[model samples]
Target: MLPAQICARNERAKAHSSRYNSKRMKVGTGRLRPHRSISAGHNRDDKRMKIGNKSGAVAFAVMFAILREFVMKFVSILLALPLTMAISACATTSTDASAPAAASMAGAKLMAGDGSARGTASVTEAADGLHVLVKAQGLTPGIHAVHVHMTGTCTTPDFASAGGHWNPTGRKHGMNNPAGMHMGDMPNMTVGPDGSGAIEYVIAGGTISGEATPLLDADGAAVVIHAQADDNMSDPAGNAGGRIACGVLAAG
Candidate 1:
């Protein structure tokens, strides 16, 4: 009876031990399952982070490229503006430098008068045309006809002739009349009792070139004062009588 009781007790003890061992193994397996799931979730999070960083890097590179292109365009425009203005200014200066300057005639002797008449003439450029300044002294008061005549001849005691009025186009006498007027025909000069006359006006169509027939040529010309006043309409010389005084024109 004692031996049978001992065997039953031993059997009950072994069955309880087996059940505790099985329960411990089940608990450990449950903990290991959670750890494996956590590790897998961490791996997935790492992959997502790597993808986001790569995308952000690509976006930054694209933004930098756009900014660089915009900056280059802006700088190019800034460099060209001043160069255009400088070229325009240089062109204007060159044109002004090529224009003709004023001319003058001094210390000239008259062919007709006994006493020498001192006169001065000047030419200046203007926007519309040329401004001519002429002054004569030691002359009779009244109206005298003044003209720019042809020929440089003033070689005689009598001084009866200085050739004819400078008529390059072979025209007649008149002022502001295009067709038949002498190139030398100008407005009549009125002298005061002081024996001095000054003439000032603008000549619209005149130049100082060898190609065109300039008033002042290589052979030179004469500014002569006639005895009588010009009729202002005569064909040859406006019937302005004889040449009273003559002054030779030459380049200085």
Candidate 2:
């Protein structure tokens, strides 16, 4: 009777131990699954962080490019400033240099007493004296006497309204007068066969518009051409004939 009971009890004990070991293995497998899931989540988080870092780098690069472009434009403007100012200054200097030449010239248009001869005269002040340049056409082809008359009036026919030769020095009229020639006395102008002539004269101690005896004076002056040549030695008129052309000297 004792041997059978003992064998049955031992078998029951072995079965209980087998069930406990199986349950422990199932619990270890569940823990392993949880660890795998945690690892997968960590991998996903790492990928997101890497993507964010790359985006930040790209944004920084874009900003740097924009800033560099702005700097380059600013540098270009700074480099051009001096050239622009230089061009402006050159223009101003050129305008300033041309001021005196425009102010120093005087002009006159001459007409014959009988409306036959016509001419132009330009007066300029040089370093030496006053330069008088006369150009004429439609005049007789011979030696003609040209003089600066005292009065500016050139009224008609004989043109007697224009007074005597301009003698601010109170001297005689002729160049060969010996006592001292008048300031208005000039050499004879010989006209060509085509009736065209030119004369240039520099009157010593005479001016267009200065402190000296000016052609454009209070009563003004006249450029007069005589029909005949002056003999260069006669007293008042120098034997010069009638006044052919006369022009008033006006301030311009």
Candidate 3:
């Protein structure tokens, strides 16, 4: 009787123990499956975040490259502007260096009294006094008295507006006068057969540059040609006839 009872109790105990272990294992497996699913979801989210960061980095690099290119182009343009301006200024300066100077020349263009002649005159300050060179054409081909008048005025017809001879010292008119000799008296000029003549006179007594006998004073002076020859000793124009050709002396 004891052996039979002990065997039945052991079988019952073994069955209960097996059922409890089965239930505990099922619950543990269910919890482990849910944990694995949550881990996988987290890994997928991390991958997506890494991809977004990489895209953002690429966009920033592209913008930086564009900005660098634009800045480089602007800097190049700024550096070339001054060189271009300097070259243009140098070209302008070269053109202004070829003109003639104006301080070494004094001249005048002669107009005829009766519109029958034209001439030119040039005066230069020399070491002695002043040198005058005069050239005339289309005249009457005869002896004519040429004198430097006091006034520069030369009107038409009679040419009486040229005034008297250039007598700054208030002496007599002729070169051989008894009381005095006028500074404006000059030798007679003989025209050629072709109605053209040239005279070059170097003034030794008077001056065309100084203030004493200045040819280019405030009132100025003129070269007047008479119709007749001078007697050289007569007073007041040496008996020369009417005025023929006159030219105002201009200063340079």
Candidate 4:
């Protein structure tokens, strides 16, 4: 119904319009737009999840480090407590042992009646036990009673002023008797005509240190020689009268 050239032109125009509309329809509803938006959202979510996972990992690492530190500190404290207690116990034990030995080494000395008949006494350690060595010059020549007395005073006309025999246990006299006599009572001391005597005897009761028993108090005590022989049966003190020589017993 139209010229050949015009018909060709119209047909070409329709073809072009159809192609463009088809392309537009396909872009709007075919899957490309929604697919692209969904893909981008998925990528964003994945990134957010990765960030969250990394944050969680960091937190877990920090907590683990703190836990490790706490555990180490607790273990160290536990270990130190016993070691400290052991050291303290050792120190206390050592002090206890040394205390008695030190007390025995304290100052000790001896004297004679009115300090006239002077004698020197020494303390020495023996395998058996402590030994008291007493040597005296100038004394009566006969069997005499030798006893440890109370008090350290040496100045007096009659040394009897030094007080009675050293009776600490408050027991009756006579070492041979069931009742214990004074601590100072000793066997008879026999002196030669030369008026000299040497006596060696062990301390029967206990050691010089107060750890075992107190031989001499802080004020000190005395050892004396009696004028008469001890019958060895008398109570309190032997009939022995008059203190001839005296010595002060100290801690040592």
lDDT of each: 0.72, 0.86, 0.80, 0.70
For all predictions, the C-alpha RMSD in Å is 6.7, 8.6, 12.4, 8.9
Mark the 10 consecutive residues where model 4 has the least summed lDDT: 101-110
Q: Candidate 2, residue 179: CA error in Å?
A: 1.0
On residues 1-252, what C-alpha lDDT tens digit does candidate 2 reach at each position? 599999999999999999999999999898889888999999999999999999999999999999999999999999999999999999999988876432356777889877655889887877787789999888999999998888888999888998998888888878887885988888889999999998999988777765657767778788889999988888787888998998888766
What's the ranking of the predictions by TM-score, best on top?
2, 1, 3, 4
Cα lDDT for residue 100, candidate 4: 48
Tens digits of per-residue lDDT for model 1 on 1-252? Answer: 699999999999999999999999999998889888989999999999999999999999999999999999999989988998899999988887897543433224454566454576555544554455668777789998887777765654434456788787777677745566776777788899998887876655554334366656766676677888888787778889877777776655
Error of 4 at 194 (Å): 1.0
TM-score per candidate, in order?
0.56, 0.59, 0.56, 0.54
Better of 1 and 3 by lDDT: 3
With a 3 Å backbone cut-off (N, CA, C), the pairs that clash in candidate 4 are 111-246, 111-247, 113-245
Scored by Cα lDDT, where does model 4 land? 0.70
The residue ranges of model 2 lying beyond 4 angstroms of the native Cα positions read 1-103
lDDT of 3 at 225: 83
Model 3 lDDT per residue over 1-252, tens place? 699999999999999999999999999998889888999999999999999999999999999999999999999989998998998888877765665333334677778866655788787876676677888887789898888888877788777887899877888877777865666677788899998888888766555655566766778788888889998877888899988888888877
lDDT, candidate 1, at 184: 71
Regions of model 1 farther than 4 Å from truth: 1-39, 55-117, 124-131, 151-163, 175-179, 202-204, 210-213, 216-222, 233-235, 239-252
Query: How many clashing pairs in candidate 4?
Result: 3
Name the 10 consecutive residues with the lowest summed lDDT in model 1.
100-109
